[model samples]
Target: MSYPTSSSPRMWWTCTYAPGAQPFRGLIVPVLEEWSKSNVSDAFPFLAPIDHLLGSRRRISINLAKLFNFFDQEIVQRRLARTGSGSGSEKNNDVLDILLERHAMSKLTRQEIITFLTDMFIAASDTSTVTVQWAMAQLLRHPEKM
Candidate 1:
């Protein structure tokens, strides 16, 4: 939850949830699966699984791209401007703001932004969810050993 950083001010890093929170997902998922069976013929019965997979992915992508954009607009452009070439500033206070600002003064375009966001979304979401699932499964099967 908290770790030491080399930076002057020790940053209080925040994870979305605590480490033990993951195994609870495994328990809740099984309960949801059982419930889905009873409502299988209902209109939104299949939403649980589909959303569990897709929603995490989508949000992660959007957030990460926003993160990169903020840095690009804030840190990168400021450094670039010292050379009298890039003279731009972002309107907002985020990663995407910084990136969009730099892009306005540099070579990046909308197409690249979309492509990067898409790839990052797919990779970060799927890998994170699957890894959590696998770890939880293993822990459930070997609680004593763990």
Candidate 2:
């Protein structure tokens, strides 16, 4: 299956002021795909040793951290700039705005905002893609149902 086209816009609308660009797609899609792949260590505890030997878990963690940093730099910084500038035109009505508001009030740190935005993107994009894939598969298998 191809990558979810809607995921980029959805994540941009939800967390970034710069919706025109979708640099995060490169990082997010592959990371999520890698994460979704089943690993032998998951099925057998004894295989965990080999996972470390293969550096699989370490690679995943590093990629996740990279994804998190991308979201932080792209989304969080843009939101902070817009909110900090006190410009009405830059105002956002999305989750990022709420998180930035919290950041302004000292209720959340920069890292927390980044983490929340990353989590939101991953959860929303993955869920939407899986749901669409399942629906398409069902329709293909049972044309009469559609």
Candidate 2: count the clashes. Answer: 0
User: For model 2, how does the per-residue alpha-carbon lDDT over 1-146 read when each residue is reduced to its tens digit?
Assistant: 44664455453455443666667776777777777877888999888888788877887788888887776676656666676887734755666667676877999998887777677767866787789889999999999997
Estimate TM-scores for all models.
Answer: 0.33, 0.70
Compared with the true structure, model 2 gives a TM-score of: 0.70
- Expressed as tens digits, the lDDT of each residue in 91-115 for candidate 1 is 3344444445556777677556545
TM-score of 1: 0.33
Model 2 steric clash pairs: none
Off by over 4 Å in 1: 1-90
Residue 65's lDDT in candidate 1? 52
Q: What is the C-alpha lDDT of each candidate?
A: 0.43, 0.72
